[model samples]
Target: MSDLLANLPGRHLEAWHYTDLKALKSFAFAAPAPAAIDSALLPDLAMNRIVFVNGFLDEALSVLPAWARLSSHEATKSDLPLAILNAQHRQAGIAIDIPDDVDAGAILLISISQAGAPIALFPRHRISLGRNAKLTLIDIAQGEGVYWHNPVSEISLADAAQLSHYRLQDEAEAAFHTATIFADIAASAAYESFSLVLGGQLSRAEFHARLGGAGADIHLNAAQLLAGTQHADFTSVVSHDAPHCASRQTVKSVLAGHSRGVFQGRIEVARAAQKTDGYQMNQALLLSPHAEIDSKPELEIFADDVKCSHGATIGALDPEQIFYLRSRGIPEPEARAMLIRAFIDEALAPVTHDQARALLERAIEGAWSKLVS
Candidate 1:
């Protein structure tokens, strides 16, 4: 533990280039203590809920969905630094399995960290779907005090299965969060996910998706809203190892104050993955002069018949658009906000889940209000 703490990931590594971990070295992290949370803080979703307080399951507050069965925390085969660290102090985790051909409607998994001091919490979760099965997972993370919330999730979809995973990260203003997700999709399977980041002093959300069988598809999309001195990074890598697979990514960032945002997206197509179609695009809107954005879009293809492309754009709000809105009797503040909302709408368009969409909109509204004020 001491060695890992002393040698935390830094900017020297290409993966951590945009986000540094120097500040994390300042805190003396201890094991998280048992904490309680207000029920009102939970989202208003009409589904079974699994709540984790300080990285430990709160069985009293959690009701495992009827279509899902909970199991023990299984071993992880990850080489990433954060995942290794999570395995070190790994506590109880939520493991769920859905059988073949069953359509599991939806479930909510919420993690809340309410600590009084600087502590560290690690939560590992796994979800697997059988052949032709379908499921929707709404994962939300929010917290109260100074702490580190490092979570790792492993997801697998069998042939002909479909999984819709949505995430909302609205942690405390002083919290540090780093999440890693791994998804494996088989033939004719689809893994669609969208993550909205609105909190954490310094946070990074990384995803790795692999097309292990033919006819697989993946959609990895995300949006980040940052204010004050907050820093947020969204990085993803999609691998197409089979023929006729498709992947798409669209990321947006709204920066305010002195906040900084980063997006690094890479698409890899193997030699045998012929007829692969992959596309990635990242756009950022800087709301303040001091705000910063770093965009890196990459494509590495080894297939001759694959269509892969990547693009990135970074700019401020167009003055002409704001002026046009103001001329229509709209205030300057409202005008600017209208444009920002329009920019984010494209990324949020893919989310069709009613409750999940509402949760994201509410959080985005609150973050914009706080950012401007």
Candidate 2:
């Protein structure tokens, strides 16, 4: 009943400057309908899992853990344009609530979108951690055909809670995907997150994390590997409204063909957050002359005693290094891949979950196999 384009963000806005939505206006997206996919296509990760197909829950394929449940969507309080769009068509999402002092091992949230007429899907998911609770969440997005997958996740961490969040975005070559995450962390809570962007025609992932209590902290790290004409964007805004809080971000992008990558990160420290420690870095490696990358890192501080910094770098692979590897009898394609793996090693360090780490690394390997040689 509502007009979807009424509030769609475009290049005119600074947030969407590098990424545009004008192409979306051309499609008449029908509501998401049921679609089937082969189980073989799913990743071989070992974890309690839930599956969503075309925005609808596939109960038959889901294996929920004790800490997760099928529940009504939690209304989001986000005013971001992407969140607002997701809220409009949100159907169902799983809610994971870990009580105090519990360690819920690992949970996998898999989204599979099959090919069909142009459609749009919005899935709203929630995660909550009680005092001192711990959890590892692996979120994988993979799909086929032309469509838009817009999802929103709301996270809450009580005092002293620790959460390791790993996300992999591997949408279809013709699909458009946008994911918005809102995290509220309490005193002494830590949210460690890493996202790997490998697919999607035009995609963007945005994070809004707020340190609401003293001593809270966050680590946001991501890597984007793209080829062809693909476009991907990683945007994050971290706010420190409480004292003694800290935030760190390191994002890397590897571009080939004419693909483009964008990273926008901002850390805001309030006057009362005197002990805040914030740092951000964005780096990119260009494999083609036509490839492009945009990096924007910012720090806004009102606290006189806070330590905050931000920086960015964009460059191509070192020709001398490639020549040296060749002199050592290494092939060009393999050498390039080796350097890329080394470039992203720091970004992957925060991924402590062995299985999830392997899965993400494998995906990158697969991408490069097709891209190089």
Global CA lDDT of candidate 1, please? Answer: 0.88
* Model 1 TM-score, 2 decimals: 0.97
| lDDT, candidate 2, at 90 | 79
Q: Model-by-model lDDT, in order?
A: 0.88, 0.89
- Mind giving the per-residue lDDT tens digits that candidate 2 earns over 46-131? 77888888877777887888888877675766678889877876778889999999999888899999867877888888999999
Q: Which TM-score value belongs to model 2?
A: 0.97
Check candidate 1 and list the clashing pairs.
Answer: none
Regions more than 4 Å wrong, model 1: 1-4, 66-72
Candidate 2 clashes between residue pairs 3 or more apart in a chain or in different chains: none
Q: Report backbone clashes per prediction.
A: 0, 0
TM-scores vs. true structure, each candidate: 0.97, 0.97
RMSD of 2: 1.3
